[model samples]
Target: MMRALRALVRKDLTLFFEDRRAVVLSFAAPIAIGAFFGFLFSGGGGGNAKIPVRVADLDGSSVSRAIVAALEKDKALEVKSATSADEARELVRRGKATAAVILPKSFGEEAVNAFFRQTDKPDLLLLRDPSHTAEAGMLRGILTQHVMEVVSKEAFSGPAGLRSARQALRQVSEDKAMAPSDRKDLTVLLQSVVNLQEHSTSEKTEALGPQGGIGVPYDTKEEEVTAHAGETYNGYAHSFGGMALQFILMASIEFGMGILIERRTGIWKRLLAAPLHRSTLLLARGISGALISLAIFLVCMGFGMAVFGVRVQGSWPGFLLLAVAYALMASAFGLLLAALGRTPEATRGLAVFAVLILVMLGGAWVPAFIFPAWLQKATLLLPTRWAMDALDGVTWRGLGLASALPAVAILLGFTFVFALIAAWKFPSEEG
Candidate 1:
């Protein structure tokens, strides 16, 4: 039985490889598509692309200049100075800049006073392009953090410290038993506090905040936790996973066509005349198709990793399990297609349309997260979705073997159902 199955499998492989165009289309096309998408979505090595921003600093004060310097230091933004608010707005309107930050003429003075004396706050105007709202939001966050840091520094060093010092002097003045000279000294301290409160120089950093106090303006530290530690995200990983699943389904057409041709050409009758049982012959064909699909999938992924830097950060064993299950499902689907369709021509057209729909709904072209909530739930019913999910999980998601079990089970369940249907409905040579 094993020898007969091996011979049959070898025959199928020989016939498949004889068609050079089919081989190239099945493997090379998906690799090319994955590379294109990988480059497009990866943003060329996972770095944030800089958004152009215009800064309109009308105050020209040291504080305003510090803010401008901070904005320029951010790698995510390309900061350009604008002479006027009108010029900044024009840049945003012309699509040359994503957003414009405008500081009013009294911004520096107000900002300083607001921190030290609890005075009226300054408003910084942001002119953002409506189309680039996400970029504008990011810029807003950066600006907010910078403002908080500057204010926190001023609060401790400037008015906050002077206010505390003045209260201490006022308490000392409340002592009626103090000597005249001591009282005079207390008054001097009180008056100095008032002068510092009213006419404090922004340059007096040492005299700011409470004595011996270290103020941390804000928390700028970042902490990131990934499923796979030490593994940088590779955009090509997901792209290759998605594209491999899509092309594997598309390749099912060839399997269906091959079965149809075999039945039409009386090859099925010749195979039945051999010592092999009818079920055994069908099983051999299914195994051959599954092997071919698995080979194509691996080749595509291998090419992606070699040339495009795609990495499998998760369990390789789990990834192999998913590949095998999906290949079996693909084989079963092809057999079912052949069993259901009356003619090869009709089956080809229907298989193409079906595969394309499955690919789209399976999140082959886009991440499943982009799907509407209802659609995302609905896609759970699709075998392709599970296949894509399992591949993505084990690849870029860095999921373990345990995490991939459910997807493997679902794909195997689909394979069983498809195989049962094909076995029941497959055309007999006599018919």
Candidate 2:
């Protein structure tokens, strides 16, 4: 029994190695995909991947200017200037910036008053898209640190420091909210701050908090912005987009493979014997394949919507247009694959590999915005990328048909090219 088993294993190994294509694909596919994943994910980490942010300094005070400069100097932030809070927020909504940090009018004055005298904390609006929630947290932390530092320097060591110190001393004495113990502590701290001005102009003063407490000066009011003003983000919209695109394309590949199988089984020979031209036969296959893929795509999206509350938040017309366009493109892609494919055994592995690469670059697994700046721009060349964007635009982005028109046009263009090439290559007996 052992001898027979060894013989069987050896025969299998020999068969596998005899087909050089099989041998190469078995090993090369994994290696290639692994390397590609490593390259793609490398963009997510490291110092070079900075979050893009817009800073709107409505308060043109010296303190606000210093804070803006400090934020600009940070390695983790790519800062741009904005004229107003609305302008900065618009950038975030449009994806031009990851977050918007708006220093409102009187922000500097109010912050200083809050710290020295017990006024309401100054509000700094932080507007961010829902997908960028992680980056928003990072920005808030960064802003907090920078604001505290800037406020501390201004309140304790700037030309107005002595004045703020005197103001704090008087306010501490008159405050009724403070406990006796806390008031005593604040009195000593304030008096010492006042004495510093008489001794040395350059002396550093410890930052004061409202009511003599220790804290950041400004309050961050975060608003999670979605595609629409009232609508919440539906994560399923994006996931469905990527997953449907992938499976529909896979189904298209199956349709293409069917042609090759029919040829092998002599069904294609009988079809070729008919009076219909090759283009006519090929177009029928393409159309049927497109309809099938579109049906699959719609079924999946319907499941997502019915179960997960995913809505077409944008234009319904745009959503349908993109979905149909992608279905056609995917069918064409399948034809191209069939025209270029060898035997089923040889083509399946290579086709899957190509599909995986397309999906990876198309932001199927992760948002393309998370990639480094260059990779984000580079994905624009891919049809899968356009498909993903168009799907998102019509779903979560609340964009109209005009916004999706470009993607629809591109998908159709790719479809035309794929079909033209497949027809040219279809007549050849060679794979």
Candidate 3:
């Protein structure tokens, strides 16, 4: 029985390889698609693409100039100076810029006073293109960070910082040894510090909601933890992972169609007339399909690494385990389709449609993060999601073997279930 199964598997493999078009389509198509997406997302070379921002500085004050200078310094922004707010707005409306920042008259004075907590915050107008909301949001965040930096430097500097300055000024105001004029000045300074502190506290409270949090309110620091030193994020890693999974499904469908073709041509009947057992025949087909899928996956990923810089940053062993498990699952799925499908043409069409739906819901074309929260939760039931996640974990996420085990386990479970269904429904010689 083992010899018969091995011979059947070898025959299938030989037939698959003889079709050069099939081999090329299974391997090359995925790599090509993945490279296109990688280049699109990473700007071809993984450099940051700057968002164009038009600034209309009507105030011409030192503060406004300083703000413009800060904007220019940001790597993410391409700052353009405009003579008037109208001009800046026109630029945004015409899609030349993402947003228009207008610094109104007296902005410098109002902004400084606001920083000292002695006046209302300046109402700078931010006119943004409706179509570029993401860019506008990013610009807003950058503007907020710049303002916070300026305020923190001015209000909390020198020997008289936020806490110490308020304390020192209060002590001077209460001292009878000081002149009335000096005491009055000290009192005013103390009030400014007190007001700023109170405002800051109130803002923090509002941001934290009713329940206070343990972490810092304003997160200015960012730290990247990588599995390997000097290793950076590769956009191709995600693109390739998704593309490979999608194309593997297509390959699986083709594998199913092969079975359908054999059945239509009476090849199954011829094989049954031989010494081969039904169970052995089914196992042979499953093994052949699994081997083909595994080879295609490895070739696609290899191309990704060599051409697009994708890497298995975590455990290579774990990554290999995931690849094998997913390939087996895909093979079993193909066999199940073969068992359930009625005719060759109909089976091919239905299998393709089902594969497309699986890919769409699996987050193979887009990041799962973009999905609605509920939909994201629901996608957890999909085998493709587990496969994609496992690939991501071992590649860009830099997760270890331990982290990939659950996904591998889930894929193997799916394989077992699919194989059982295929076995139960497999066409017999008697039928």
How close is every model to the real structure, measured as TM-score? 0.52, 0.88, 0.55
Clashing pairs in 2: none
Measured with C-alpha atoms, the lDDT of residue 18 in candidate 3 is 70
Error of 1 at 21 (Å): 27
lDDT of 1 by residue, 268-353 (tens): 77888888877897798899989988998999999998999777667788889999999999999998988887667667766776
Candidate 3 pairs with clashing backbones: none
TM-score top scorer: 2
User: What TM-score quantifies how close candidate 3 is to the native fold?
Assistant: 0.55
Q: Per-residue CA lDDT of candidate 3, range 1-431, in tens?
A: 99999999999989767756455556655676567446545544444457778888898776667778888899888899998977776565434576778888867555554553333566777876543456677888998666555434434432223554465566776689979997897687667666655676656532222121111112222112233433555767777888888888899998888988888888888888888788898899999988998998899999999999888987798899999999999999999999988766566666776787678768687644334445556788889988887787788657779778988999999999999999999877444
For candidate 1, the per-residue lDDT at 113 reads: 50
Which ranges of candidate 3 are over 4 A from the true structure? 1-219, 223-225
The C-alpha lDDT values of all candidates are 0.71, 0.80, 0.71
Q: After superposition, how far is residue 410 of candidate 3 from its true place, in Å?
A: 0.8
lDDT for 275 (candidate 2): 83
Q: What lDDT would candidate 1 get against the real structure? A: 0.71
